[model samples]
Every structure is written in structure tokens, then in C-alpha cells.
Target: MRCRASARVDVSEACNLLCVDETQSEHRFEEALLRSLHQGVGRKPRFFAVGAAEESFDERWLLQVLTVAQQGDMASVEFLVRSRVNKTMQRSIRFLIRGAVGRFGGRFTL
Candidate 1:
């Protein structure tokens, strides 16, 4: 899902996304599509934040955090916090962490 700064994505064109699943060799990306809401990868995100002054925001890590949050993976969230992540970005994920804890009943530390 990484994109170069100079690259632009067009929604009208055919999808070129590749998805992988452990249970199957190939998985259709549409399986996770929010058809009713007409929301998917091509759409722009609702929020954007600047990372710590010393470090740039890592979109890949943010995506991973979001995925694990949806799955209620508190351990993974903690592990990511303990990794080489910046303090500001770590703070930014608190809302996601809070939502996961509220739903899954687990504590989070950063």
C-alpha cells in the first residue's frame, strides 16, 4: 500500500492491489470492502498526523496498528509500541488503543 510521493492513484481504473491470506494462496481484496458504505482503499483517509519531530510518520506501521486493532490484538499493539516507533506517533495511536481496550478488555502500555 506504499505509494511514492510523486505517484497518483486513479479510482476509475482497474484495481492493481494484491492481497495475501494464510488460509488461502490468493484472496480477493473485495472480501473486506465496505460495499454498503462505498469505502475502500482508493479513498483518502479521514485523518492525518505528523509524527515526532525527530521521526517521520510511518504509514506502514500505522496500517499494521489499525489492522491489529480491528482484530483486538493488544499484544501486537504493545509490541509495536516497544519497537523503534517514535513517542509522538505512539501517542497518536492512543485512540485506537483505547478503542481496542474498551472492546477487548485489555490494558495497554507505551
Candidate 2:
């Protein structure tokens, strides 16, 4: 299963359906760590470099990474994590992240 935007995994196919928050369903965010554990699946993460484009600051990319992780796309999240993209241009989102986002708040630039 590929997690990138229109990013397709090399696998032949993905399961028809997915279950969430169950013993059967392992969170993709967590799963990505597990996948990273193996020398094969857990290599250095790759992320798309974002320049100072006005439109590139959309939270959609971050949200998409989270959503894809929720859907068990470790590679996608890894790409983001490794790439370290930032979207703090939206001040409101920064406050929200500081207020409540991720296990803990993240880095921000003024």
C-alpha cells in the first residue's frame, strides 16, 4: 500500500478493506515504526522538499501523512518525518499543535 499523494506501492495489491482500533488493526503510524525496524522496510525516510511556495504550506500534506499513517502507510509517514516538512506559516495551526497535537507539540519557527 502506497501512502504518497497518488503514490502507489510496488506491491501487487492492498487488502480490499481495513479495520481500525482493534487487535486486528495496528495503527499505521505505529506500524511504520515496526516496518522501519526491519533493515528492508525501515530504511531512512524520504520526504518531498518544500520550497518557500505560498501554496506549499497547506496543512493537507501533514494531514495526509497522518491519514495515510492511520491507514497503515509507514513509508508515507517516514517520508514526511525524514523530510521534515514544516507548515507553521498558519499561525492558528501552531497554537493548535501546541495546545494539542501529536503525543507532544512539535518545533515551530516564527
Candidate 3:
């Protein structure tokens, strides 16, 4: 999830499983997303000065948040909208506002 190597490994494993059985592609894709979402703890703050903050470039949490919105979770949807206007990291804020929304293909709306 953090890098191409790990993502490749995950996809390879999922492909192996599918080849051994007859799992649907969508199911396998969702399983892969869930597996990645629940991986190790996200980055914690590394303070260098007062009020300094650490930004999480992790996309798994991003997908999880967006997925929640896509599933009709009001609170999470509100959070995404709020985050779009806040001082969130560029990576996450862009995804929150535009990128991931488009990826959701109208399944989720702000």
C-alpha cells in the first residue's frame, strides 16, 4: 500500500487466489481495498516546533474515507466536504474535493 512493491505483492496474491478459485473481480477488488485499509497504523505527528503537524500521504485512509461517503455515511461525507475547505494536505484535500470524487463516478456526491 505504501509503495509499488507492496501493492504489486498484494495484487499478485489476490490474482493467485482468484486463479485457484472463481471469485468475482469486484469482490476481489473490494477485498484488496479492505486489506490495504486495515494495514499498519497511519503516520503520527512528528513535532519540530509548537503546533507543527505531520501530513499523511497515505491513500488507503483516503480510500476508506471516500468509500464511507460512497456508502452514504453522512458524518463521513460531511467530514470530506469540511476537509475540502480546510487546511488539509494538498494530496488529501485534492482527493477529498475532486480527484477521488471523480473516481467514485457519481456514486458519491458532495
Give the winner by TM-score.
1
- TM-score of the candidate numbered 3? 0.27
TM-score result, candidate 2: 0.27
- Model 2, global lDDT: 0.34
- TM-score, each model? 0.32, 0.27, 0.27
The lDDT leader among the candidates is 3
Tens-place lDDT digits, model 3, residues 27-96: 3434343333322122321213323465344443555566775665747755654553333333333332
lDDT of 1 by residue, 43-81 (tens): 333323445334324445545665675567778877865
Question: What order do candidates take by lDDT, descending?
Answer: 3, 1, 2
User: For model 2, how does the per-residue alpha-carbon lDDT over 29-89 read when each residue is reduced to its tens digit?
Assistant: 2233222222222233344445533433224554555565445555665565444423322
In order, candidate lDDTs are 0.37, 0.34, 0.39
Ranking under TM-score, best-scoring first?
Answer: 1, 2, 3
> 21 in model 3: Cα distance from truth in Å?
42
